[model samples]
Target: MRSAPRSMSEEVIPLVEESAVVGKREVVTGRVRVRTVTDTIEELAQADVQHETVEVTRVPVGRVVETAPEIRTEGDVTIVPVLEEVLVVEKRLVLKQELHIRRRVEQEAVEVPITLRKQRAIVERTDPEDPAPEGPPT
Candidate 1:
């Protein structure tokens, strides 16, 4: 430290100079987006399904009957006889007709169309400062 002059006539003047300093830091220049996309796909598939069907047939009974017959079923055939009484000089019963029921089962192969969904992820990074991923370490 130095003292100032006692008189105003005796005074000292000092010279000074200025300069600039530079530094670096990390800044957010761009952004990265990640999202998922869903897609639908169609394909052919196979499955087993069951269906039922019935068949009926008529038979003639041209004979005399005494009483009504009960419903009878066979392996795949059922017989049901219809009876009626005829009024004449001689009161008697007769067989009107009969019904035949036939049932059969069969299997078949069929193709079916099915729908499926698939998902995929997409990542996009846009930054002019860093173009390549392996260019620098994060």
Candidate 2:
């Protein structure tokens, strides 16, 4: 088919695409509550404790020596010698007395009262619309 020729003056048209602005905001979905609980229990504990006792005794030994004897310990018994100087024709060292110390150990049963405490935390969740949720929120 044949078409007619257009006029010298013609109108112009412009094309455009739609656009929008997107933003984000925070929202409270649920609330969390926490509480602590304390508990106490009684129990018995056993242990072995050691203690030592000493018994001192004085023994008389009158003897003459050139010098004083050194303190010695035999087994659990300790021997401490005492000396004195006598005035005669010349000075002489004499043994006055001796002290014997013995040590003994004894064991017995004892009981004591004690208190112990334990604590635990409990959590509860609540929503704005619903009081309790069946499962965790996605």
All candidates' TM-scores?
Answer: 0.55, 0.72
lDDT of 1 by residue, 1-138 (tens): 899867657667877978788999987788676768889999988877677777888898867867777899877789988887899899777877888888766677789899999998887888856654654232
Q: What does the lDDT read for residue 95 in candidate 1? A: 78
Off by over 4 Å in 1: 1-32, 120-138
- Stretches of candidate 2 exceeding 4 Å from the true structure: 1-14, 130-138
Error of 1 at 109 (Å): 1.1
Minimum summed lDDT over a 10-residue window in model 1 is located at 129-138
Q: What is candidate 2's lDDT per residue for 27-129, written digit by digit as tens?
A: 7788776778888878666666778899999999989999899999988889999998999899989999988999999887666666689998888787756
lDDT of 1 at 16: 91
